[model samples]
Target: MNTPLPDVANSELSQALLPLDWVGMQGIDIPLILDEPGVDASVHARADLYVNLPMPQIKGIHMSRLYTLLDRFAEHQAVSPASLVALLELMVDSHADCHSSQSRLRLAFELLCKRPALVTEGLSGWKSYPVVIEAQWCEGRLSLDATVDVTYSSTCPCSAALSRQLLEQAFIAHFGAGPVDSNHVANWIRQNGSHATPHSQRSVARVRVHIDQDAEHLGLLNLIDLIEGALGTPVQTAVKRADEQAFARLNGENLMYVEDAARKVQQALATRFHASDVSVTHLESLHPHDAAASSSRRGTLPFQAFDKALRA
Candidate 1:
């Protein structure tokens, strides 16, 4: 028996132009093997992907091609800026060959690390940290960006002061009223500490940067380290007695609010890399809403340049 294929072009009508800014698979879970310095093995990660397409297309793109490219990247690629640029180039080339015109790629994943505890001697199992890589190419030119999300604890300065005052009043009530010195008051409070607790604010810092295609790039780990150092008190994972003590000292020494966290990150990036076009967003725990700040390096190209090139 012979099977006859139906003719789909019978309707003589043109396909409607769909202006899709972005079109691709998302929430795609895949096990990735990552390679980093100080570690000579594979680490697992899951990626969410996206790509852009042009209008007047016969149908949607072949999503499997994006996954296949990502699979290859996971098996045999580094996550550094340069590696990301190359990966984006590969995505664009592959997509163009498949879908025609230009293509874009976005991969967001969490990079897990076995961080040591603040005062503990042993290491924790694992902590997932967020990372995002994005790239686009058109007319043979490519652009790339990378981002990371870090969490840390922030002690409200105003709340800390109020707690101290309430404790001091209680102390005066117990011991006959007299002017108390700061040191003596502190010592007395430590000796007889009670229910009063300082307010804790959970904060998240997100840093995104445009990659300079020509320079030797630092990997995501480096960016993570920089952000942690800037914040001065990242939440701990694995812990021992010593680690706990160190963490306490760190919190006591570096109490801050969401604003402080954002400023610190901004200053750190500006001074270290002259990162003129980077953006920082700090999610505040003290209030219901979030606070965000953006800083750009002088003379860096704007996002519109990429947009224009892509359209051309």
Candidate 2:
């Protein structure tokens, strides 16, 4: 005689006759292979996978099934737009008992890439960009949202203007009333060229874009390039004296406020992606608090929800 295995989920009955909007797993650690093309990509991503439990009579959805489904997907498919959509589809299909109508998956990981020094020949270093990809299938339509966190330097325009004013006063005091000799003025400037340098601080920008459903690829690298390029002052990877000088010139030329940085990113993303949300935070060197601003394309995404998603 042989013993039969028991299926607890199939046998169990619900204590409360109510359905849950989302029920499954949260923070499932998994290894995701990213096929970004021409790169050796691998990430240990923390994923939140869930499906709506719409059957009130069922005790609970197949929790083990949900986990196994995700596991299978992770093992077989590389992380991409098409794979994500297919995984969600499988997740919803597996929960046939609950009649699951919607599924959501969120993955958080850091993407590493080699960045070349701004001015040094044959010099490069690695940089990590924190990324989050969220996919949802509801009402028979799938939506993909991606967020990237990029760091850069921002010089305060107001602080730069104030520093210029102080320098002008200092120059007037040194040069005196009428026409001073050119050699004397040049000497004074050489002595105090940076008498009043503007205050600059390291800032972070979080950009979220709603990608078109049915997009061939996630386009993570391209999105990153566009955002970093728009800002024009990404934090460097490898730095020599020349590289540092180049960085200083960049900061001096692209002086902007927190709001200006946000709008610049928002406009650039809107032009490229057509729908995006941008939020920038300037960790001020002079002030104790940080300066921040957020913007979104009109009617693309609700401001409150988009801001919350950025924080999440």
Candidate 3:
């Protein structure tokens, strides 16, 4: 006996009244080829994508079309800001084709970086950083936002000072002379009297920016550099002896609290990117809570003025 196949419908139902926004998808994982400075060809990343559509007289959008576009992008394209803009434009155009007026896309993923070890030579490991890219097209205009999460080390100044005082007392008890020369005292204090074992605070810096049309050309590498340079010391991936020494020196020179980290990042963005809007969040390891700071330029004001406002 032959079995009969069930009939499937290719069309969707139409409604008289539609909701404000209709289409949305979440937890979509797609492998993308990403381009960054110093990296030729492409690097792999998993992207989570979501898109929204406006309904004029329909109840829903063509969700499969969005997925198909993403599939094409993942298969044979480099993911960049310009490419992202193009993708958003495509989404909006496709939405229009589906009889919609506006469209939006949100993409999130973990970007991987291969960094040399801090202590060991010729050794490397992978470090994954979180990134989010969002785009929206409405009223014939397009806007974009990008975010990155970076980790670093922060040391509390108050803790460092107290630890040093304890070490100084211990030195006085042991050495008996209590550092004869001022230079000797200073050196002894640094070596033994203070911070014999310095407190280590692991912190994360999350930065989000509204990318201007001109700044959209800036590569992810540049953004990463800005963030890491602002933080002073990024956590190491692979570590050799020499790299460990370098990182140690960096940590010793760049001790900071959560407030200091936020201020540093704010200043760096003001000087380098001159971003119109930026936000920084620091997740502190010393405490159970997190601290967040944000700075934005107002009404076409200069970045210096915005910095002053933010600081104030």
Candidate 4:
């Protein structure tokens, strides 16, 4: 028989002999079966899988092993908390030589749902909501988290106030203390009402939450509904004249700033979900940069710090 080649990963030693906090792949493009409970069809998703290396002498991790295990799991098991636990257990067992104990998975995909127009008859179009699910297993305990990005329109309260003041000034100048005739006022307003309209811009809100331990199913759809309902003016598709007019009325009635958007989402999620964090970013049309605000439920840890710690 011919001489067999030796495996360097297991037999060789590291040149520096130091352990790494995290050593694995990122941005891995793999197709996964996203089978949320109660959903009719499975969603095809892109995922990233990783594991930590805690041994000082091990040359490198078995990258292929991680990939193979993830592929098998995706092929067999539906994505859920229980499946995440099993996958992390397999990851730890696969690294017996290195004594590794941590594993992570991230999946990103667009949730496609049919949304009806504000005022349309038998007309609906698909709206895509960007979603991300992150799971981590550390020291035998597994945790799951998810985030959804919702885009809506936000009107600046300050800008609205300034616009109203300017309009009032114009009206006073035009009337000039004459007997205010209804037709004259109506004609003036019809012509000049929109001349000083408030500026509104497209805004985005990213709502993230830690799944409750006792929950049985994923809450992606529910979370999206909650945020959209609270905002009261989500971006729409399949719009006609009536729908556009309805949208304009909504913007006029529910004027809000970035801070208002964040608090609205935070409160909406807090009342229903166990733990939640909300970040609202308004792409200001009048400013060079976007305005952002972040909020969390009462007595909950700050989301920024917690997010950093989880990644670290």
- Candidate number with greatest TM-score: 2
How far out, in Å, is residue 53 in model 2?
Answer: 0.4
Model 2 regions lying over 4 Å from their true place: 1-8, 38-40, 181-183, 298-304
Model 4, 1-312: lDDT tens digits are 699878899888989989777666666665566556433335667777777788888889888888889889878987777777788889878887787888877777787788888889888888888888878777767777788899999988899999999999999998987789999899999999976989999999988788754466677877888999999889998999999999999998889989999988888887886677788899999999999998766334213234552343
Q: Which stretches of candidate 4 lie over 4 Å from their true place?
A: 1-3, 37-44, 176-184, 298-312
Worst 10 residues of 2 by lDDT: 298-307
Better of 1 and 4 by TM-score: 4
All-Cα superposition RMSD per candidate: 5.3, 2.3, 5.9, 2.9
Q: Whose TM-score is higher: candidate 1's or candidate 3's?
A: 3
lDDT winner between 2 and 4, please give it. Answer: 2
Best by lDDT: 2
Cα lDDT tens digits, model 1, 1-312, are 578765343323237756556666766666654445643235445555555565454345557777898888877876655666676666666666335555666566677777766644456657778776666665666566666778887777777788778877788786767666889877877877753656666567767666665546445677778889988988887677777778877877787766677778877777555342334444555567766554445435324332222222
Candidate 2 vs 4: which has more TM-score: 2
Model 2 local distance difference test score: 0.86
TM, every model? 0.74, 0.92, 0.77, 0.88
Q: 3 or 4: which has the higher lDDT?
A: 4
Please identify model 1 stretches exceeding 4 Å from their true place: 1-14, 18-22, 39-60, 95-99, 120-125, 172-187, 215-218, 274-299, 302-312
Q: Give residue 309's error in model 3 in angstroms.
A: 23
How do the candidates rank by lDDT, highest first?
2, 4, 3, 1
Global fold similarity of model 4 (TM-score):
0.88
Q: Which ten residues in a row are the worst by lDDT in model 1?
A: 303-312
The residue-by-residue lDDT of candidate 2 on 1-312, one tens digit each, is 578888766788778889899987889999989978644488889999999988887777888888998889888999888888889998999987679989989999998888899999999898899999889988777888888999999998998999999989999887778888989888998898899989999999998888777777788888888888888999998899999999999999899999889988987887777678888999999999999998877545322257667556
